[model samples]
Target: MNERNHISIREAIRGRITDGEWAPGAMMPGETDLAEEYGCSRTTVNRALQKLAEDGLIERKRRAGTRVREIPSRQAKFRIPILRHEIEAAGGAYSSRVAFRETLKAPGFIQSRLRLATGARVLRLHTVHLSDGQPYAFEDRWVNIKAAPGVVDAPFDIISANEWLVREVPYSSGDVRFSAMAAGQIEAQALATSLGAPLFTVERTTWLRDLYITTTKLCYRPGYHMRTEL
Candidate 1:
C-alpha cells in the first residue's frame, strides 16, 4: 500500500475523536469493523491504532478494548531553518555577521515574557543572517544566561542562532506569535531596503527545562511568507 494509507487511517481515527463520533471513555469500533468500513485490513487498522495510543490520543486494554482519551489535539512542531542550506550543503560559502552582543537588565517586555524575578540579566545579540552574499533575516534576540550560560561563548560565524540552538540546547517551552509590522529606518538599512517597509515578524520565546532561555524577534524581508497545513 502507499504511504498515504497510513496517513488516511491515522487521520480517520483522529477525525472521529475530534468530531465526537467517538465519545471520550467510549470504546472504538473493533479492528474488524474498521477494516470492513475502510476496505483495508485488520492489520492496517491495528497499526494506525497503535500509533494513536503511543501519541496519547487513545488507550487500549487487553480485554476492555480501545477507547478515546481526554487529551486535546496533539500538535507537533518543527524548527525551520533561517536560510536555505543548499549553499552550505553544496560546499558553497555560508557566512553570518554578529553586529553586536550586550547585556540587558530585564526590559519590561522580557521581564514579563520570561517571567523573571526582575533585574535579571539577558544577552542581546544583533545579527544579520546571511547566505552566500545575500541577507536572509535580521535577528534581534535576548538570551537568558540562567538557562544557557554557554550561549555567550557559542560561535555564530558559519551557522545561524536558530540552527545552533536546536542542536545544542534542549528547551521545554516554546511560544510563537506572528504579526505584520511596518519596518523602521534601522530595519530597512540592515535589510538593504527602503524605509517604512512591510515586514513579517515572528516573536518566539523558549524555556530551557525550568529556567528561561531566550526570546527572539525575527524580521523577514518583503515577499517572505510561511505556510503549513492542518
Candidate 2:
C-alpha cells in the first residue's frame, strides 16, 4: 500500500529468514503466494526478495524459483553517508567547500571504468569536506551527464555532490574499494598534512541498472576509519 508497508514486507521476510523459518537451501514460497500471505501486491514481494538476493541471503534462478542461500556469503551493506550526517554523528561541525566544478571529455581510465565510449563528456567536481574547520577529506568525483543530467546544474557550493547524487539518483548497484596511499603534494596541501603521509582512500562506482551513474574517490586525512557491523 504505502512505502512504509513496502519496507515492512521486506523486514518481515528478513525476520523469517533470520528466525530460521526459512532455512538454508529451503525454497521460498512463490511470489503470488507470498503476496497473498502478506496482503501486498506481487510487486512488493518481488522487491523484498530482490533485496534479499542482493544481500546474499537468497538465490533466485529463472525457471527454478527462489531459495535460501545454501552457504551465505553475506556482506554488510553500509548505508552511504551524507557528510553532514557523518560529521554530526562524530560531534563535529560539518562544512564543505567546492574547490572545482567543470565539464570535460572523459579520460580513458574513466571511460574504461564506466564502460563508456572514448571522448564521452562528463561533469567533474572536486570538493573538500571539513570537520570543526579542519580538513577531513578530499573528494574527486566524475558524473556521467548522460546518466544524471540534472548534475550539470546542481549547486555543489550549497550541498555536496555526494549528498545530492545519493538523494537524487536511483542507483541499483555499486562497489567500493579501500586502500592506503601516500599523500602527494596536492593531497598533502588540501589535507594539511605532511607529504607522503598515509591517507585512507575510498573508491566507489555506482550504477542504475545498466546506466553508470558516477565514480568517486574520497581520500581522507590520517586517522580515518570506516566501520560496518555484521
Candidate 3:
C-alpha cells in the first residue's frame, strides 16, 4: 500500500529466515502467494525478496524460484561511521572543518578508480574531523558529479562532506579497505602530527547501481583503533 508497508514485508520475511521458520534451503513461497497472504501487490513482495537476495539471505534463480541460503554468506558487513556519532558515543565533542573544496577534471587515478571517462569533472573535498577540539581524522574525498550533481552545490563548510553524503546519498553497493599508512605532509598538518607517523586509514567507494557515487580516504590520527563485530 505504501513504502512503509513494503519495508514491513521485508522485515517480516527476514524474520522468518533468521528465526529459522524458513529453514535453510527451504523454498520461498511464490511472489503471487506471498502478495496474497500479505494483502499487497506482487510487486511489493518481489521488492522485499529482491532485497533479501541482495543481502545474501536467500538465493534467487530464474524459473527455479528463491530459497533460503544454506550457509548465509560470511560477508563482513561494515556501516559507514559518521565522525560526529563516533565522537559522541565516546563522550567527546565533535566538530569538523572543510579545508578545501574544488571542482575539476578527474585525475588519472580518480578516473581509473571510478571508471569514469577521461577528463570527467568531479568535486574534490578535503576536511578535518575533530573530537573534543583535537584532530581526529583527515578526509580526502572525490565525488562523481555525474552521479551526484547536487554535490557541486553542497556547502561543505557548513556540513562536512562525509556527513552530507551519508545523509543524502543512498548507495546500492560498496567496498571498503583498511590499512596503515605514513602520514604525508598535508595529512600531518591536518591531524597535527608529524609526517611519517603511522596512521590508520580507511578507503571506501560506493555506487548507486552502476553509477559511481563517491570515493574517500580517511586517515585517523595516531593511536586510533577501529573495531567491528560479526
The model with the greatest TM-score is: 1
Would you list the clashing residue pairs of candidate 2?
none
Ranking according to TM-score, highest score first? 1, 2, 3
| Residue lDDT tens for model 2, 84-189 | 8998899999998888889999999999888787888899898889999999999889999898888999988888888788888855589899899999887888
Instruction: State the weakest 10-residue window (summed lDDT) of model 1.
Output: 78-87
Candidate 1 structure, TM-score to reference: 0.68
Tens digits of lDDT, candidate 3, 139-194: 99999999888899998777777778877774547888999999999999999999
Among all windows of 10 consecutive residues in model 3, the one with the lowest summed lDDT is 73-82
What are the models' TM-scores? 0.68, 0.68, 0.67
Candidate 1's error at 113, in angstroms?
1.1
Give lDDT per model, in order: 0.77, 0.88, 0.89
Cα error of candidate 3 at position 217, Å: 0.2
- In model 2, where do residues sit more than 4 Å from their true spots? 1-77
* Global local distance difference test of model 2: 0.88
Where does candidate 3 clash, by residue pair? none
Worst 10 residues of 2 by lDDT: 73-82
lDDT of 1 by residue, 1-230 (tens): 54678679889888988789998778898888988998987878888888888777898898888889866446455445445473465454666788778876879988888878788888888887656667666778888877667777777665666677777675457888888878787678778877878899888898866677788988877777776443
